[model samples]
Each structure stands twice: as structure tokens, then as C-alpha cells.
Target: MKHLAALNKYFWKYRFRLLAGLVFVVLSNYFSVLAPLITKYVVNKLMLLLSPGTTHAFHESVQDPLARVLINRIDRWNFSNVVALCGVTLLVLALLRGLFMFFMRQTIIVMSRHIEFDQKNEVYQHYQRLDTTFYRSHSTGDLMNRITEDVSRVRMFTGPAIMYLVNLLALIGLSVYYMLKDNVALTLYTLAPLPLLAVTIYFVNQLIHKKSERIQALLSDLTTNAQQSYSGIRVIKSFVQEKAMLAFFRNSSEEYKTNALGLAKVEAIYFPAMSFVVGISTLLTILIGGFMYIRDPQSMTFGTLTEFVLFINMLMFPVSAIGSVASMTQRAAASQKRLNEFLRLQPEIRDKPKATPKVIAGDLHFDHVSFTYSHTGIKALTDFDLHIRKGQKVAIIGRTGSGKTTVAQLLLRMFDPDQGAVKVDGTDIRDITLKSLREQISYVPQDVFLFSDTVRGNILFGNPVATMDQVRQAAKQAVVDGEIAGFAEGYDTMIGERGVTLSGGQKQRVSIARALIKDPRVIVMDDCLSAVDARTEREIIGQLYEYLQDKTAIIITHRIFSLFQFDQVVVLDDGHIIERGTHDSLLEAGGYYADLYARQRERDERPSEEEVTQEK
Candidate 1:
């Protein structure tokens, strides 16, 4: 029930529909309780004809003075006609039950759908609000599981759990009222065995809750493992580790199965025991009532016994439903706790309370900024002080793990620096609204991620309202226009998931085009051109040189062909800025920058074996 506290907003929103559904449930229960009443009259009337003295005994049993008048409606009519009349009345009540059930299901079930729609989007939007730090610690598959399976579990509570719980209470209330009216002694006798059912259910409910939590946790791990394996299938294949990966999957899957089987075993023990307890109630009712009937029809007549037995049978569902209802409640509560923990996370990198929507002027500065990744506990950048005036171009060159990308990340405010401040136009980035700050910057990362959409759509994702001309122009600048044109549907052609259908170089080109379309005030390209060959890289950089003159740009790459185009070059080593100068000045220093430039030049100038053979 505490888990449901999070869903109060949704419940309040659909309160009217839920209220109407409950009204229908009340009407349905009213109609449902009428069947036993109808059967009671039919039995009493038949008994009156079969055994004439039984009716006078029945009159003595009830304190009602008009018991004969109420019980003997067919005194002037024959048995068959009266039986037909009772049958018709029963049929009409059954029809009304069906009608009310339809309305109840329509309002409640459909309201569940509406709640699902809103809750799913709310979770998705919360994900969007979360910063890169949250994602760094959270797995993709776990988030996916929370959004999909977790939402479905909560939705079950909204639909079947809610509908049945209320209806069960109403049915039990009405049935008890009618049963007590007929014979209070039998009603008390029927309830004597119910405490045993409640005791059994209480222990089973605890087991169900614990087992369900374990099963759901195992499922999250399994989903995360499976998703990572699929995403990294190419790595596994290249290393010929298919069997190894499959074995790992098998182990995780087997563990999940084992946990699930344990829960199933608990349910197996529970449902049968619950049914047996309900059966005890029925057996006790029949045995004692039969004895009473044999002794005297006045105390418990055949009609009253028949009606009482019918109501005892009705108790079967509420008793049996304890297991299913408990199972759903436990699963949903476990999922809710997981989802709430994630949703409750406030982003470390977000707009401050008094943050202003300041338009960036592109004067960037990292004032002795230092940062350490939380998971690794290793400093990615240390005392990194750098500045770039508006419309200046800067190139960052560093060895692997030298923190070239961390600089770009800081500029984008993906992860705030642990010490010192990153300022834009003389104001701390934290002082500016994240939307306005990020909106002014266009970043193209080393690993490109494209949506499963047409080439044009992917390009336009940077600016959804971009014109087709702008799209084609950005493609041309990235030197991918010819490839797009060659596609059968050109810009309309659908790309596979994450652009997996495209070659690596092609994907990089499309990513570049996307960033280009944004036309941001500040642009960051973090080793984005490594996939393209020397010739295409040169062409793309050449085309970008003119357009980027009026915008601040940061290029992070190992390649040095376009190094001279930048106004400044900064060299990083072990999270420290070891060298800083223009390309010529850095080469003159004859340090890390010069050594790296020489290595790149050698690789680019080296020819393939075919060219060497031709010379021979």
C-alpha cells in the first residue's frame, strides 16, 4: 500500500472514472446476490407442494408474520408455470450482472490504460532530465526494464488488482448479509474455518513478498546481461568468444530460472492450501446444515440450506484470490520501489534555483577545473586552466586516457567539475540554465549514435525544423551527400537501429552532418573524424573551416592534417595540460605535441603494399 503512494497523482486524475467504476461494481454485486434469493423462493415453493407440512414448519422458523405469503406465491398456480417464472427472473438478473460488468470493466480497465500512458511518459521525461552521471552508474537494460516491465507491473495494480479487490469486498459483504439473515448459526459455523485460511495466507504473503523481490532483482541482472551481450556481439564474434558469452548468458539465465521456480513453488503450496481451507468451510456447512435439516425442517429448511450452500461456494473466489492478489501486490511493490529510487534521483548537473537563461557568447574558460569520475575514483582532469575568446578555434591532442574527451564533456556540462568552475562569457556555467547553455553548443562525439530513422531525419534531429536544403548542405560539407543520393530512397531511406546498416565511416559522416545542421555558437568535435580516411577527413575539415570562422570550435583528434587550422593547440598527458601553443609553436617545443605530430605524419604518408609493389 505504501508503494501506491507514488501513484496518488494518477489516481486523483482519474478519480471520477474510478468512482463510476465502483458504482457499477456496487450494482453488479447487488444483482449477483439476487441469484441465491431467487433459488431460495423456488426451493421453498417446491417444498411446499412436495411436503405440505414443511411450509408450516418454515413459518414457525422465521419471526416474520407474513412468511407464508412471502414463501407461497404460487398457491393458485401449478408447479411447472411457477418454475418457469423463477427461471425467467434468474435469467434477467444474470443479464443485468453481465451488463454491469461491461460498464465496470470499461471504465476501470480503460482508466488503467490512460494511467499507463501518462506514467510511461513521465518516466521517460525523467530520464531525459537526468544527467550523464546517472547514466554512467546505471545500465541501459536496467533503465529499459524499469520503463517497460516495471510500468506494466504498476499498471496491473491499476487494472485487475483494483477491480477485483473492490468487487471481492462488495460480494463478501452482500453475501454475509444475506447468509446471516437466513440462519445466523450456519453463518457463524461457516466462518469458524476461515481463520485457518487467514493464518495460511499471512505466512504465504510474507514468502511471496520476499521471493518476488529476489526474482525481480534477478530479472534486472539477466536483462542487463542479455542486452550487453547483444550490443557487444561484434566484439564477441571477433574474439571467437561466442561459446564463452553463451555460457555466461546460460549461467545468468539459469539463476533467473531458479529464482522464478522458487517463487512458483511457493505459489503452488499457497493456492492449494487456500482452496483446501475454502473447501473446509463448504464441508462444515453441508455436514452441520444436513444434520439440522434431518432433525427439523423448521430450524433449517431445504430451501434455506440450498441458498446457504450457494453463498459458501461464492466464498471460494475471495479465499482463493488471496494468493493471486498477494502475488501481484508483492511484484508491483518491488517494482515500485526500484522505479521510485531511480525517479527520486536528482541530477548532479542541473540548473540551479536562481539560474538565468543566458545566451552564450562562446567565451569559454576552465579556471583550474579538476574532475574525478565517481565510479573509477581516478582524476580525468587536474588543474586544467584554458580559455578561448569568442570565434576562436582550439584543438586538443592527447594520448588515450589523457582526458581529451573530458574537456568536451565539461564544456557541454555533461558532468560538472569536482573543483573550480567552468565559465562561459565570464559567468559560471552552473549559473546558466542547462537548456540555454547546451542549446548554444553542438557536440559530435567519437562514437556516433544515430537514430533508427532516415538519413534526413537523423540530420534534422539536430534541428527538427531544418529545411531540406539545409540538410543537403550539411551532408555536402561532411562529404556524405553523394552517398545519401545513391540510396534508393535517398533521404527517406530507413536506417537500421543505431545506423547499424551503415558503414562506420558513413555513420560518422551522418553524425557530422547532424552536428553541422545545428549551427550552434560553440562546436566540439571529439575525435569525430578518425573513422573517415585521410582524403575525406581533409575535405570535411576544409569545408568546415570557412563556416566555423564565426563560431567557437574545439577539435579533439589524434590526426594532425587539420591541426594548423586551429588558432591554438593544447596537449594533455595524465590529466594535466603539458603543452599549450599554436601548431607551429607546439612543434617548435619538441615535446609530446611534436612527437605525436611526427607519428601521425608518418602513418598518413605510408603507402599500402600495392603502391610499393608498383614502384618495384
Candidate 2:
């Protein structure tokens, strides 16, 4: 019921259709009750037809002599007429039942589809707004399960659960009404076990709900395992750990199986116990009616007894349906909990009241900024101060964990800083809308990632409306134009999932081209040239300087050779700035940069000089 309560808004929107379906159900139930009366007439008529002189015996079973006379006068002794009446009743009941079932299904399906559509979209949109902090803590497969499998469970609850429960209630009400009309004493006797049946359902659902939640959680774990294995298939093969991966998957699957079996066991016990109650009610009805018939034949008519049995028979399906719907409702309740947990989360980054969309000129300044992750409590950046005037090329160098990428992320507004401010064109980035800030900056990460799409599409991703000439020009600037032309279809060649079809260097170049096409005011290249050879890095940098003469650029790298071309260099250590100067000035100071440069120059000369002297 709680799960159903969450879905009430969607249910209300189409309540009219539900009402129409219910009206059909009421009509269908009434016709079904009439069906047993027609059946009773057919049975009694058949008995009378075979034994023509037994009309007096049939009448003697009635309580009142006037009622017996009335029945006797109405009992036409014709086989065809009785058969025709039974056939017409069966046809009418079948038609009404079929029509009601169709409408019920239609309404339920429409409701579930609309609900699922809205729910999925809402979840996806929420996921989009959530910061990297959430993603780093959760797996892709877990999110996928929340969006797909969990939502499907909600659909099952709304669709089949609604259909069955509504029809079951109608069936029970009609059956009870007809049973009482036939014989009040027998009807009361038949209902003796109903309260126990209800109690069984309630507890069984409690157990089912607990186990179902566990099973769904285990299923998410299994999905996570499978997704990780597939995404890291190359790593698995390289490490020769296929057996280990298989063992992990097998364990996850076994856990899921055990939980599912536990759920199945609950169902197995609930239904049999529920059915026993139904059987007991049926047996009691028969015993009571038979005794009443034998001791006081005038108390009941054969037709009335037959109709009572038929009505009880109709009650069986709805009663059994209650057990089944109970199981579905429990599963839906568990799924609802998962969906609500995800939906209730607010994004770590929120827009300000004065946030407005404004185009960026990419003049960035970091003013005594500091940040720490919420969980780790370790500062990624501490009182970091730097500035990049418009159209300046600034290279950042640092050891691992020196907060190199944090600068780029802050510029993109991935997460707001805990202290100080990051501004672009004299406007605090936090005050600008996230979309507008991102539109003016392009980031190419060290570990390049590309979508499963054509090369042209990947290149134009940053500027989807860019012309083909613009895409080609950006590709050429990244020095990948010749390589793209070598492909069978050139820029039309499709990169496989996550760009697996391309080599490491090729992927980096493609991503670079993607950023280049954006023609962004600020371009952030985070160690993007690491994979390429030194000579190629120089060539790319040459082309980059020429192409980006009027744009601000942030280059993060470790190569001392690559450090010489920047308009200014900023060196970081332990999340603190250690050096900020031109290349020659830092070298003359004979500090950290001087030591790194002299070591690199010695390594390059020693190998080359020996090779040359041997050749001479």
C-alpha cells in the first residue's frame, strides 16, 4: 500500500479510465452471478427432463407451498429451451467478462507506461545534475539497475497488481452477495476461514518484502560485477585473472539465487495455506447443504443448492489472486524504497539565486582557494593562488596528487570550493549558471575518453553545429588529419565503445580535436601530451600555439622539455604552489625546476653521445 501511495499522483491522472474499467467489472460481476442462476436452472431442468414425473419431488424441496407452485408453473419441460437459456447466459457472461478484462488491461498498461516514462526521465535528469562526488562513490551498473530493473518492478505493481486486485475484489463481493441470496446459513459457514486467510497474507507479505529487498540488492551487486568485468576485459586478460573473475561472478550469482529461493519458499507456503482455507470453506458449504437437504428437504430447492455451489466455485479464483497480488505488492514496495532513496538525493553543487547565463572570455583567477572532499577530509588544494589573463598559455607542473586536475575541475564548476573564489572575466564562476560556464571551456583529460560514435561526430561533439570544414581544421591542428585519412572511411570511421577501436595515442588526439572544434575561450589540457613521443609533442604544441593564439589555455604536464613554451609556468607540491616564473628564470634560480631539467638533459645526451661516438 505504501508503494501504491507513492504512485497516487500518476493514478489520479487516469482515474477516469480506471473508473470506466471498474464499471465494466461491476457489470461483468453481475452477469457472472446471473450465470450461476442460469446454470442451476439448466441442471434442474435436465433432472426434470430425464424424469418427467419428478416435478412434485423438486417442488417439495421448497420452504413455501406457494413458492413451489410458482416454480412448478415456471419450469418448462423442454430440453431445447433449457439448453438455449444456458447457452445465452454463458455467451453474455463471457462477452462481459472479456470486455472488462480488456479495458482493465488497457488502463493498467497505460498507467504503468506513463509512470515508468516519467520516473526514468526524472532519475536520469537527476543523475545528470549530481556532481562527480556521487559518481565516484557509486558504480555504473548500480545506477543502471536503479533506472531499469527497479523501475520495472514498479510497473509490475501498477499494471498487473492493480488489474488482479480490482477484479478479485469485484469477484469476491459478487460471490458473497449471490451466496447469501442462495442460502444465508451456508454463506456464513463458508466465510469461517476468511479472517485466517487474511492474517496469513499479511505476514507472508512482510517476509516477502524483506527477502525481495535483499534479492534486488544482490542483483545490483551482480550487475556491478558483470559491468566491471566487461569494461575491464583487457585488464583481466592481461593479468590472466579470468578464473578469479569467474569465481567472483559465481559467488555473486549464488547469493542472488539463495535470496530468490527464499522468496519462492514464502510464496510456496503462503498459497498452499491460502488454498487450504478456500478448500475448507468449500467443504463446509457442501456438508451443511447436504445435511439441510437430507433432514428437511422442504428447506432448500435443488436449484438453490446448485446455485450456491456455483457461486462458491466463482470465489476460488479471486481468493487465490489475493495471494499472488500480495507477493507482487511486496516486491514493488522494496523497489519503491530504492527509487525513493535515489530521488531524494540533492546535488552537492547547487545554483545561486543570482546565477545567470553569461558568455565567458576565459580570464580566470584563483584567489586563495582551498578544497577537501567530503568523505576523505584531505585537502586537494590549499590556499592555491594563480591567474591566467585572457589569451595566455599557462602550464601547470606537479607531482602526483599535487591537485593538478583539481584546478581544471574547479574551472568547469564540477564542485564549488570550500573557501575563496574562482573567477572568470571578473565574475565568480559559482555565480554563473553551470551550463553557461561549461559552454566557454573545453577540457581534454590525461586519460582520454570518447563516445561510441563516428570520428566526425566525436570531433564535432563540442560544437555540434560546426561545419565539416571546422571539424577538419581542428583535426589537422591536433596533427591527426593524416591518420584519420588513412582509415577506410576517414572521419566517418566509427570508434567502438569508449573508443576501444583506437590506440591510446589516437584516442588522445581525437579528444584533442574534439576540444579544438569547440573553439573555447579557455582550453584545459591535463597532461594530454604524455602518451606521444617528445618530437610529436613539440609539433602538436607548435600547432596548438598557432591555432590558439587568441584563446586562454591551461596545460598540465611533467615534461621539462614541454615546460619551456608556456607564457608562464606554475609548479605545485603537496597541494601548495612552490614556483611561479618563466622557464629561464626558474632555471637560473637552480631550485626544483633546475634539478629536474639538468637530470633530463644529462639522460638525453648520455645515450645519444655514446651512440654517435660508436658510429664514428
Best of the candidates, TM-score = 1
Over 4 Å off in model 2, which ranges?
Answer: 47-77, 561-564, 602-616
Error of 2 at 305 (Å): 2.4
Candidate 1 segments exceeding 4 Å error? 55-76, 562-564
Candidate 1 clashing pairs? Answer: none
Model 2, residue 455: distance off in Å is 1.9
What is the lDDT for 200 in model 1? 83
lDDT of 1 by residue, 337-408 (tens): 888888898888888999999888889999999999997898999999999999999998888999999999
Candidate lDDT values, in order = 0.86, 0.83
Q: Which ten residues in a row have the lowest lDDT in candidate 1?
A: 59-68
Cα deviation of 446, candidate 2, in Å: 2.5
User: With candidate 2 superimposed using the best TM-score fit, by how many Å does residue 206's alpha carbon deviate from the native?
Assistant: 1.1
Per-residue error (Å), model 1, residue 234: 2.0
